[model samples]
Target chain A: MTLLIQVQLPDGGWAYILSIIFVSLQVSVTAVGVSTLVSLPVALLVGFTDFPGKRVVTAVINTGMGFPSVVVGLVVLILLSNSGPLGGFDLAFTPQAMMISQFILATPVITSVSLSAVESVEQSVRDAAFAMGGTDADVGLVVIKEARYGIVTAILAGFGRAISEVGSILIVGGNIVFSDGQSYTRTLTTAITVEARQGRYEIGLVLGAILLLLVLGVNGLGSWLRSKGRGERSA
Target chain B: MTLSAATVSVSYGPDTVLNDVSLGVEAGEVVTVVGPSGTGKTTLLRLLGMFRRPDDGTITWNDTDVWGLSETERLAVRRRISMVFQEPSLFNAPVAQNVTYGQRVREPWRERIRKSIRNLVGDRTLSESARDALDTVGLLDKADQNALSLSGGEAQRVAFARALAVDPEIVLLDEPSSNLDPRNTAVLEDAIRRARERGVGVVVATHDMNQAERISDRVGFIYDGKLVETGPPSQIFDTPNDSRTKQFVDGELMYDVEETTNGQARKSTSVSP
Candidate 1:
């Protein structure tokens, strides 16, 4: 009975479950953080200013909102490949490569949604700020402060997109789980695929459940932060 | 400072709104511009505030041509002048911030927030400018409340306090009491009187001839984009030089109708349409 209890699978790795969860958490946090910081200023500028080619820039960002994760991964792959100009950086087939792909995938969603958020601020608020002898920058800051809750919601939406995507990470990171075992990088989605292919159904099921829980946790936090921000504003 | 506009004219596209309008406002004096609807009274106030450039004219403040100033210089001039719009225009910020807007401070806002609070809610040891302004407007108790929470008239009064907090040389009121009830209107009139007592020149655009007569030292009647007549309140009210001014004051202007068979008829006889 003890012999039968011992897992029979490719490499027979018992600690793969914890490793996959850790890797997934790392990727999700890094992707969300980098994308949020990079997109905020772009969103604000696009939302408020009127520069040359603004319409074209807006159109391009809107189109980027619907860009597929796989397409983003493919583009980054080409840029980081041996024949590509950026190949000297040696970022391909690394976690950083996955991060770059996820950043590209998530930024436009944040920017477009944030633009909508800023646009929805009342015209009266803008007029009041202007009439108070506020300069353009001052008025813009006031608008951003007024729309802070909506902007946070946009960031959460972008985070949701970045964390849930599997294709970009798969292509750019190669989903390589190291043999050293203690220091491996294998996300939940890739680990589930590897486990399921080797007929380890129980491990795959557990990993899938964890992934679902992670997504739910992120969404729940987003909703709570949005409500908290709104309550503060009203109060 | 004395404020004067000479031959000020404003046009929107092909439509002329104010034409060759000249008026002077002396320090510590209240001047009211009375007009029928669409007579460009508000446009005149905007021109005086430097918010709009005149088609052909100059506004002289203390005998200096205002139109010659650059935008930055004009903004600096505007800092010494404030306007109270017909409707209260408050920011979305808290009441304290709104009152202290356009004020410059050498310290960080967080460090200065306590000073602002003391100014808004008067200290027993010292007189507070914000508190005095609010007290004059009958909104001293509502100093801590959000500006958005005030009633329509209360908001307008708060706007008056905000203007006063800046200690401007001149205060331009665009029908400040037009939206207020009789009680609130009385409160506003008292505030205007107090502002005048503080030596701030007051220019008001109003349709209520009675209020104009009650508070104004001088009254000017605007008709068809022109300064039809202007003189002391007694002269403008009792003996208007222009027939258009008389028709407007007597409520016999026939504003809606194209023409009336009885030019002096007090009541309507028929509807053309």
Candidate 2:
């Protein structure tokens, strides 16, 4: 306990804490940003348009929401492996790989929820917009604007899932980090696991505390953004 | 400036809502369609506005068959003929935006938007043509307010303002004053009078016989999805020739009267004048 306290008193422990928070936030933000960018148009299309195989596409997307993160990690790994096609670019076992895996895991969540949000906008509003000589693009913009608050909530929920997820990032990132002598990368979850196996309970507890605080902070900001968006819309 | 519908019939499945309804409106005319509920009064206005397709009819505007046109051409025709719904149907936007909806202004007209407002509403510092339209409807004070905040009558007036802002050649009103108080109804009637004076053809659908008689130069009576009679208001109201028209205007069932009085029912039909 005394050694753990002494370790935390130094700048090294503080650096580790900050680095973990930064990596977690970077991974989460990138995952959510990419998912949001990719999912919005898909959500709008599913919500608005009618065509053949629409039900099949919707069913696939709904099925994707419950897809296991480990499976996503494995799929990405197989594609980015050295023996796989186009694997010569070598993005495996890197932060970028983790980002891609997290994005795949988060996308369906955002898409499904956003589709519901966009669908909830009244059809009367769409009719009114079209009657005013607005084109399809104009109607889409108006519907998205009216559904902005709900879409934001969907995105925030995606972020929450991305940050809290560990399985995909662990497999894809390999979360290695170096200290004292060598270079490596290590995520909060992986580091805690390694420390616990080494009987470094204090270090694992500290990391756990930091992870809890990070999740709380994310949830807090998400709620704040949702409320702010709601207020702006109502006003 | 001239709107004409010939043999217009609208059907949904086996149920026909309007059948062989022919009407014409020239510039400076206020034509009102008076009927009981579900008698195709509103459906006739929608058909004229090109919002609904007739199963068997042609709508011609100024001698041009509008129904035969392509969708784009139909939209152009629709732009020329604006509609005011029974309810307000305003957007969740400011009043100004609602009025200028679907209207395009040239560069010169864009600059004149402010000036046009002043010209339309003399001595008032009008913001835009929308404000002037609201002024025309006597709701200028509510121009900046959210459209959703309006009372039912005020919202309907806003809808009128929106229709007026487009400077349409023909205006189709479906029960415009049906949801308003008498004062608001008078305001709407006056607006209709002004619209007619400006040579804008007006076709209003109403269930109120007195209101229709007050504003309409000509009135068409629709009964059971068919046009029963149409003529000058004096002819339709004071000198109706059809037994069904008399029974409707007098608010009684001719069948019941016939059954009750047998031979005496024929006298009551002539007595409805």
Candidate 3:
């Protein structure tokens, strides 16, 4: 019990905690940003257009929404390994590699959810736009505007998934700290794993609390958006 | 300018919606298509509005075949026209925004992008045309209100304002007052009159024969996928060329007995006293 109290703080104190938090925010936010850029357009295309094998593509996205994170980490690890095709980039065990893993983890969630959002827009809105002499692009813009709240909810959901995930980022980031006791790639989730494994329950609990807060914030925003969408629809 | 559908036919599988229907509208005219429901009145308006291509004929805009033109050309031609569907289908936006939707979509791409960015930065000023359209509809005071919050009549009026805001050479309306109270119906009829005074050709499809008599300079009666007869309201209503037109204008019961099956009688689509 005395030892537990003695090591309540991590080796570098508050700066260490702040650094890992910053790293986690940095990596996860960037992954979500890239994922959104890729996912939104894909969702719109898949939702609005007709093509051969569309059902297959949608099924693939739905399948990917629940894809195992550790599997993604393993695939990313192999790709970034020295003997792999991308070995020249030297991204293995780096924050950039972790971002790649998280991005893969997040894209499907955003795409699948955003596709539903886009599809939820009433056909009447598109018809109205067309009746007003809007071109295809203009009609698409109007549909997107109507579906904005749901799309925002989708992005928030993606961010939640990326931030709370531990498996993929841990494998790619390696939870490393610099010699000066600054975090290199260690994130909140991986750091929690490390602290718990090292018998530092106090630090582990603190990291867990921060992660929970972030995830809760994201979920709250999603709930708010859903309600706002419902309210707007009612109006 | 003249918009005309020549020998146009539309089919849904084995069921024909319109067959060899020909109609034309010149600028500064109000041509109302009057008929019972499911008789291809809306289909004719759609063809004239260039919303769909005819299965067997051509739609000519200013003597040029609309379907023969390239898609870009078709879009350019489409900009010269507007349509108001039976459902108002208002956007969940401010009344001013809904009114100006047509004009905004018609802006040049660069201007559209700039305006979108400006809107994002809180530019909520109503455009001159939007203000004029709302004024015409007598809803200028409600410009800032969210369109979804408006009453049914008010929403339909806003839709009329949206169609007029574009200043199209031609406007098509599908059952514009089908579900309105008398006061709201009066406002809509007034707006239609105003649109005609501005030299914009108007085509309205309605089953309300009274509305047809009030607003039309000329009325065409459609029945069973065919243009049964067309003439001045005086001639079509008081004196008629076809027995079907006479039966319809006089409010006589007309039904396709074959359409009834299995103890389920098809309700008469004709407006009755």
Candidate 4:
């Protein structure tokens, strides 16, 4: 009777569940952190400075934002494969490859949105800073300080892009299940793919529920930050 | 020391704003520029405030051409002057930070350390000076509030207080009292008086003849991007030499108001297919 009441969960649930969650968090967070560090200066330079061919640079970045994940996966797989140019160090099918793929996918998402965010500030703010005897550096910092909420939103969007993707990470990570009865190179998104393909309906549902919750949590935090930013002025 | 703009000219793409304009502002004096809307009053103010470089001529403080200095040197010179625009233009921060903005509060690392020592010994002199500026503008009670939440005129007053907190040698105002009520206007004028009393030169651009008449030591009437006439307030108001100035002071100059209903009608009709 005790055996009759038993039910199967995702990899029998909790043991593998926490591991998978940790792997997903580690990869997405690292990708987002690196992406933000690289993209912030790009956003600032594009948003603030005037120079020749700025429109071309903006167009390229804007186009990159809509690049297909499958196409990015194909390109990265070729680059990291044995016959490809960057194969000397043998980085293929490793966590590092997944990180590089996610980083590339996340950067344009953060950069384009952050560029628009910085550009949306009122030009009068710059003039006022100058009038108050602020140097150019002071004015730049003031503008960035004012656009903090939008920059945060850009980060969240990039994280969402990196974490929810399967096409790129699968090609780069190989999604292998090891003989030790544990999944290696398996993230929540890639595990969902494996479970759904194997007709393991319950496991797929559980992993999917967690993924949705993570996305919801990030979006909720973004909205809260934006409202708090608005309240300071409206208060 | 005197701050003067000599033969200053400014243009906006195709249209000229100020042409061959020259003015000298002496310490302890209030020089007001009066003109119709769009005759480049704000442009003249921007040129004086170092917010814009003129198309021609030079601005000199104490007989040194401002643009002749290096960028860092120019910035140092700019720190000694403050400008208040028609808009309140306050940051979203608390009123205190807004007041302390132009005082090198966020100085270089080395300068900040020295400033911290000065603060420790002087017993918060900068904070007290900010409070004194707010008190002069009658916003001392609201010092801790977010500056953006103030009413339009109150925000402008906060801006004035912020300018004063810097202890600048010159104050440039661009129609600061145009949208203000009488009480707030009175408060602003009193603040201007205090700045002048501190031996600070004041340059104001305004359209209200009565306001210009009330506060000015010398009044320059600008017309068609040129200083058509300039004299003492009593002389310009009571005995003007230019017909254009008389027409303007008497409210008879056509095409004077930039946003007149007739202009709007013509604009709309012209845009119709």
Candidate 5:
């Protein structure tokens, strides 16, 4: 606790804390942004239409949602390594590798949650849109519009998962340190792990507080969005 | 155009909702289907609108058999037909957008651009037709308001305006005024007349006997997924050909009249929809 207090009071320690936060946000935001773009359309397609093997695909997505973060990180680490299939991109231990790993981890969760969100839109709205001479595409748009807030909550859930989990990103990002003591690939979670290992409990405590605050802020936004969706449903 | 469903049959899972029912409506005609709840009035209207294929029959718009045509052709036929559900089910957007959705959906843009721009502009700036449609339904003043913010009756009127905006040849209404007060019902009736004036065949499904009488050029009495009787409103109300039809029209609420096995006495019970 004394170390945590010292880290916050010193200007240089504050800079260290801010740098970790910047790296964490960059990884999480890039990952979840890609996940949102890919997951929403896939979710809408799965949720709104009838197709063969739908149940199987849905089950696969559900399994992927529960897959461990460490396993994801290991697989991504292998792929981005110097001799691996994706090594041509030379992204090993870089922020781009972290983002790729996070996107892989977050997409299934976002897609599964977004499937429920899109399905929860009232069927009558689709019927009305179709009955209004709206083609196949139009009904899908109207449904997505009605489910916008719920989709936002799904996105926040994805962000929550991407930001809080430490195992996979740590494995892929390498927690690199520069000769000047600056962090290159160290995010708050990875940095917390390193600081705690080095007996610098103050940095770990500070980073833990930041992670908690971020998670709480994300969850608060989700709850607010849920209420907004319910309000519109009543309206 | 004359819209017709010939010997149509529809079933959902193990339950058969419509059975070999035939009906037709010519241009400038107002046809009303009156029945108790679950009598397949909505099903019949859906078939007429080409919203679904009949399980064991054929439907036609003009002289083209809708079921026999390719999917693109069926979609083309659907473009010329519009439906208004019992619940308004307006989009969660402005009234102008809801009214202009039909035209904006089928514009000449690529599919991706169509999806993104769908809410941005409504049929080239909420075109004159949408406003004129709103004016017809007394909702022109509420054009920019969020569609979901309106009262139930007002929302139905917006739906009415949306149906008219597309200039469809047939407008199907499934209980358009079932929950409305007399004043709102009168407004809906006026809208129906306007649709008919535009040479659009209007098919309405309702349990309200007065509305069927007030708006129908021909009244169809449906019972247990069958058109038990059909005629001018006076004949159906004053002296129905079928006893079931009489039992239905005589009781404002849904009621069943059964005879004893001995065929000597009659028992009557009202069923809530």
Candidate 6:
């Protein structure tokens, strides 16, 4: 005779899941926010000016958009490891390390998309701004305003990328859960991986569904904003 | 005040778009440059508007050489001059916002920041000049509507309002009514007259001889990258000095030259069908 048994969540149970969700949200939002602050100005500079090696810089950004997350994970792991160059701060296997990893993954995605959006604004628009006696800085503001929708879409895309990613964050975060079964750094994506590997298919499916809903909502909002941008431009 | 282009020239690679062009518009005067297409009228207007530095010679605001000024000074000078392109190129915003754009740019940064804070708290944002300019174009009712939602005529009027809202001393118009219907054209001409009456100098570039006759205190005929002649409209239309001006006035000259290879404009005569 054989018996089938269901394994319950360890110690903190539903509270554990909530903690994991909170960690995931905290890491992803911080990463995306920091990346945007760096990426937008870089995008604007690259979008508006003609400089030496611009094509090479643009090519690098495009290549970065498709960079493998696992490779990023490995590189970040080495940098944060105890024996590595940046080992003094002891960031290894911590949420800060995970944020650094996700920021690396999100910056190029935001920059490349935003650069395209800024460049797509019409030359006439810039000319009109200049004709109004706007300085270069003022013209930059006008272009930013004009590209606001596409920039928002780019941010959402970056958020989607940072949130759904499992490899980089997992490698850096170590998917830690404490002795009390309270999550220290485990996220939905990393948790799902461990659950599936441990034969907890039901738990894995729940995490997967939640991740899918988050990504779907983000992408849907992006598409809606993109369409609205097109409509406004055409009008 | 006077805005003048003196012996100005512009070249694009091998092509000479405008050569040895000299024109000036005094306050409260209307000067129209008339020519067939591709004859450098737009290029001359661009130079007068200080949009581009002339390849040779000078643009002057009163006694001051415009191109010789520092960038900040040049921008200050530019704030007092406005140009309307052939296409309206209205922003993707409300009509009132478009009209007030020039004023907003001309404002000091501190004031702009103050207004932004007030705007965040829901204070009124439209300036009196913006409303008055919109009223000038008979589009005050459309102030809240998206600029892009307007018809072509209404859009062009809003463009005019935007240019006027800055209280510019000089206005440069480059074929503004070339794409408009007669009714829209009439409205624009009326606005031009009103601007002149308000003591603003107006420089108009057009290929329409009738429009040149209607709005001009002085008419200039440009051909083959040169100013053929300039005089009162009656003298240009009825008793022109240059044969090219006569041919253009009689509607016989049709310029199809889009490029000037080897620095020579290739003019082609229209064929009778």
Winner by DockQ: 3
- Superposition error at B53 for model 2 (Å): 3.6
Better of 2 and 6 by TM-score: 6
lDDT of each: 0.76, 0.75, 0.86, 0.83, 0.83, 0.86
Q: Candidate 2 falls in which docking quality class? A: incorrect
- In model 4, the Cα lDDT at residue A119 comes to 95
Chain B TM, every candidate: 0.85, 0.83, 0.92, 0.87, 0.87, 0.93
Question: Model 6's lDDT to the true fold?
Answer: 0.86
Lowest lDDT 10-residue stretch of candidate 4 chain B: B261-270
TM-score of each: 0.76, 0.74, 0.91, 0.87, 0.84, 0.90
lDDT of 6 by residue, A1-235 (tens): 9865465764588888888888988999999999999998999899988999999999999899888998998999999899989989899999999999999999999999999989988877877888888888988888888888879988998998899999988888999999988888899999999988988887787778878887787788878877877776566
Model 6 stretches with alpha carbons more than 4 Å out: A1-7, A82-85, A88-90, A220-235, B113-125, B257-273
- TM-score ranking, high to low: 3, 6, 4, 5, 1, 2
The CAPRI class of candidate 1 is: acceptable
Off by over 4 Å in 5: A1-22, A50-63, A79-91, A178-184, A204-235, B110-126, B252-273
> What are the per-residue Cα lDDT tens digits for candidate 4 across B1-273?
788889998766666677899987998899999877767777777777777688899999898899998988888788888888788878877787688777754367587567658755653344777888999999998877889899998999999998898888889998899889999999999999988998989999888889899889899998767898999998788889998788778776544345221112111111111
lDDT score, residue A38, model 3? 97
Better of 1 and 6 by DockQ: 6
Per-residue accuracy of model 2 over A1-235 as CA lDDT, tens digit each: 3543633321356676566667777777888998999999999898998999999998998898888999998888888889877499798887788889889988988998899989998765665555454556666876886677678878877887787788888888887665642213356676677678878787778878888787777778777977766553354
Candidate 3, B1-273: lDDT as tens digits? 999889888876776778898888989899999876777777788787776788898999988999999999999899899998888999878788899899888788899889879877988788887888899989999987789988999999999999999888999998899878899999999999998999999999888999999999999998877898988899889898998888887777354332210112222344344
Complex DockQ, candidate 6: 0.51
lDDT of 3 by residue, A101-207 (tens): 99998999999988998999877678789989898788888877888887887788889889989998888788899987889899998899999899988779888
Candidate 2's error at B183, in angstroms? 3.0
What are the root-mean-square deviations of the candidates from the true structure over C-alphas?
7.0, 8.1, 4.1, 5.2, 5.8, 3.9
Clashing pairs in 5: none
lDDT of 5 by residue, A198-226 (tens): 88887688788989998898788788877
Could you report the DockQ of all the candidates, in the order they appear? 0.27, 0.21, 0.57, 0.55, 0.50, 0.51
- Deviation in Å, model 2, residue A27 alpha carbon: 5.0
Q: Is candidate 5 or candidate 6 better by lDDT?
A: 6
Chain B only: TM-score of model 2:
0.83
